[model samples]
Target: MKILIAIGSKDFSKPTLKLGMKVAQAFNAKTTIIDVGEKISEFSSQLVELAQDQLESWDFDAPGVDVLEWAFNYLSQNKLIDTKQTETGFPKNRLIDDGEGRKMVYLSGTACEDVNLILRNGDIIAELREEVQFGEYDVTILGKSRKRNMSHDLLQYINSSLLIVNDYEDQKFDKILLPLDYKDGMLKVAKYAIRVALALNVGIDIFTVFDKDKSQKKGSNYFSKIIKFIRRSGVQYSHEEKQGEIVEQIIKKADKNKIIVMKASDMSPIKRFLKGSIPLSVMNECDVPILIVK
Candidate 1:
């Protein structure tokens, strides 16, 4: 598995980085940490290279280099990266620009397979979308943004599964609140939840919500299969069925102590765009971290 972690800065992104790395470790994924910097104007873009050269000559790192260095330090302090790599320090000199507004440095990892740091200049969603496409990442992890549209765009456009880290405190979370349905792709979502639960040493809360106007489905063979899978995984879990608005019920049960894992909407892109979806609503409304599996 490959994971992409998007971070903004050392001050605001500590929790994001912390939780992202833990998830990556859980999956033993090849990981990349990306910092999307403010976009440089078209007129000034040509001079970016020259400015970088001048900064390096003056023993100063270029823009976004500090964030990468901070990430390197975090890996080294946590022993996530190889000891020899940590001893040599952050390889600022090795940051290679691909002439496409992207710069990257690679490092050997101890916990995961490898770690990469990338710096890009552009709109956040565009840069992230391009990176996810280029890397074919399995999951993209980032902190929750205050910009409302950011969440919508990420859900609508990003190709990979998403983990939105909101108010994440390592020791505070106690369980994975997995909301299941009889959808075709729910099995995949359940597997993802199981891996995360094992990684975090947490149990799973298997929840199913039915509409207020409609009774529960009669033959839930798929739901039964999901329960059997979870039971065999050996991760402690509890199952419950509820009646209400799907989004409201999910957010209410998630509270702040549980991380939510649920399937992405199966609606067509046009339909989802026109009328939103349950996972998106839960993502926007819940205060806890959520993994929207695709």
Candidate 2:
């Protein structure tokens, strides 16, 4: 498998690269380091020179030479190279395009580029997954913003075939959570959950949560469907049924390094607010990373 590290304008991307390398080593995958940025500036000659030295030291051949030339050209154009200052469009377009069929995109900022998106670093750490995109790879690892209290600067690492880390160590996920709602969409989500279960040598605890007395019969049917999903994944797992709030129950089961895989559902405004946004809720309360697959 090939993992691409979106080594863009974020300087903190080094940690992500380290983590990604670790993941590649574990999954026996290849790492493709990529970067997209505006031209470098003449005023930052020292920085540019430093980068040139790096390229030379690595003896980075043809493709690397082309990349450095592009950086120099961007600097000549007097354009900003940072992802944060851009107002043109999604700063992640390049990254996301590279992410096609990729495990996950390691986003650096708390909230994504668009929307009122905000993420707690701890929550993001908890939600990391090593499998995504129909069991193709693990989750994408991103760094946090260097802003305000946003700079947690914790040496946390999320595991994937494309692992990114700050130091040398094996951080494997040992437990996983699979929450299914039996929606047709969930079928794909189940495959991702099962893939991680097997890859990390982790035990998967699958659960279904629903409104109390709302659909006991339907819930049973859903549980059966999820079982089939797990069986198809060819992994050993435990199954359970819970009657309670969906987010709360899922959060209760998550731990650091525990990946929770769930289908992305369209939610109403009130529901989003009440649940406090499923992704946000889990990110905030779960103390683990929650992987939401669409």
Best by TM-score: 1
Model 2: weakest 10-residue lDDT segment is 112-121
Clashes of 2: 24
Full-model lDDT, candidate 2: 0.46
TM-score quality measure for candidate 1: 0.97
lDDT of 1 by residue, 219-271 (tens): 47887898899999999999888999999999999988999999999899999
Give RMSD (Å) of candidate 1 vs. truth.
1.2
- Which candidate number would show the highest lDDT if scored against the true structure? 1
Measured with C-alpha atoms, the lDDT of residue 75 in candidate 2 is 22
- The Cα error of candidate 1 at residue 130, in Å, is 0.5
Clash totals for all models, in order?
Answer: 0, 24
Question: For model 1, where is the 10-residue window of minimal lDDT?
Answer: 215-224
